[model samples]
Target: MIEILMWLAVPYIVIGLVFSVTHPDDVRSLEKQVQTQLPAGADALSFGAATLLWPMMLITGPVEEHCDVG
Candidate 1:
């Protein structure tokens, strides 16, 4: 048990060491990929209501865009 943990921890410790050696801009880019793709402030003014009201359509497309609008 202890021997398996020692071997598993060795590479993880090496990875942590390498992460610390990485450049700051590269690290920031990595962190930014985890968030949503919204632009800075256009969401609330433009698409906030649409996004909140129709999350499914936002994720997927509309079932019929030209169906029945009078």
Candidate 2:
């Protein structure tokens, strides 16, 4: 069970890291939507959340497009 979960998490973690690094502004924007405080390491926090919620993020599309629902 643990091995299966780890394998799943590996992809998410890798993707999350790439997204966070390449799209820091998008990650910060997401952080702003969920939290009141924008601390120094908030990017890391957002990246962690993104890893856990990758499926939702993938379904929702990019942050810019996701927010532009009018």
Query: Residue 70 lDDT in model 1?
Result: 20
- Candidate with top lDDT is 2
The TM-score leader among the candidates is 2
Provide the clash count, candidate 1. 0
Report the lDDT tens digits of candidate 2 across residue range 1-70: 9999999978877887776677666666677655556567666677777766666776776777766422
Q: Cα lDDT of all candidates, in order?
A: 0.40, 0.69
What would the C-alpha RMSD of candidate 1 be, to one decimal place?
15.8
Worst window of 10 by summed lDDT in candidate 2:
61-70
Stretches of candidate 2 exceeding 4 Å from the true structure: 35-41, 62-70
Alpha-carbon shift of residue 8 in model 2 (angstroms): 2.4
